[model samples]
Target: MSLRQTVAKYFTNHAETRERHDDPALVSHYYKTTKDKAMAKLEEMFSDQQLYDLNAISKEHGEISVYTKKGRKVFIIVTVIMVRPFQTAIDFSVTSESALPFDFGHSNKIIQQLYAQIDQHFTPLDRN
Candidate 1:
């Protein structure tokens, strides 16, 4: 992560992952699965989590919205994009709900944990 990103991650209540994120771990993740399968797996995974509540799911659009059920309370959006046949890229956005204006990197931590679970659930393509 760059100096700006590293500072902002701790100073803000929101953090997101994308295709070209400066942090290698936060880069968009590619999975060896079709969109339909990926969406299904994500839905199942999120729904099965005790800390997460399935807010909404749009298989057609490939977006899943969820909220934390305990602790600091947070909103998370998971996006799955099909780059090619059997190749899907997934990203995450997390926002911490707080009046203090910052969650002290909690949002980024949420994304990292979510990504870790996703990686464990699916076969990831080459990160490079």
Candidate 2:
């Protein structure tokens, strides 16, 4: 295998692209809106990115799973947990599917891109 593939394999075996962020501001916004509405907005956001096969939408659990394609297939899981009335925690897990052993950080790039899109689409009301 190539060096890039070898390194990717090692890292994939040891680590994964799992990220968590707590956005009280987002929770506050969500609290003002209904869960179904929030889910619809999220679905729209994902669909805007051209994600496909979005399934397993659990409103009670505040979780959604979707798939997208770049050079390879990418699976994304998004979870929005209401910590309190105005506190929310979001988690993202991105995985890349490739025949080769290495993805050259494609999964991480996907997560970053997703985050950027979210921030762009949903700018926090409270900047401070």
Candidate 3:
């Protein structure tokens, strides 16, 4: 399948529901409304080039990968950053964990940390 199709499917599959999951829509909504705003004020955000390097691939959106970590399949998704400084959202999920049994806390944390890491990597460019 094409990248766009893949991304769309992924988002649809993980769409938020009343039940609980790594709903991409819900997560995106939260980021766009809150995180995106806070990030906008920062002198440096994530640039598209940086995102591609971090993800180790070329794509306009994000990439999702699943791996076995400590005997559990962890879903690791790396999203491209459309902003400026060098930020990308990295999300992950493990079917075994339960602290956030109702939602995607772990994944969100990973994604946030990834963004911070990327943000730190870049030397802020002038804002003129």
- Clash counts per candidate, in order, are 0, 0, 9
- Summing lDDT over every window of 10 consecutive residues in candidate 1, give the lowest-scoring window: 18-27
lDDT of 1 by residue, 43-123 (tens): 899888798899999988999999999999999999999998988999899889998999999987888888788888789
- Provide the lowest-lDDT 10-residue window in model 2: 20-29
| Order of quality (lDDT) | 1, 2, 3
TM-score of 3: 0.31
> Looking at model 1, how many pairs of residues clash?
0
Q: Which whole-number lDDT from 0 to 100 does residue 123 have in model 1?
A: 92
Task: Write one digit per residue (lDDT tens) for candidate 3, span 8-113.
Answer: 5333223211212343322421123222433333213323323321213324334333332343223444333433334223333322233433333443444445
Better by lDDT, candidate 3 or 2: 2
Against the true structure, whose lDDT is highest?
1
Which residue segments of model 1 deviate by more than 4 Å? none
> Per TM-score, what order, best first?
1, 2, 3
Tell me the alpha-carbon RMSD of every candidate: 1.2, 7.1, 12.7
Off by over 4 Å in 2: 1-10, 13-38, 124-128
TM-score of each: 0.94, 0.64, 0.31
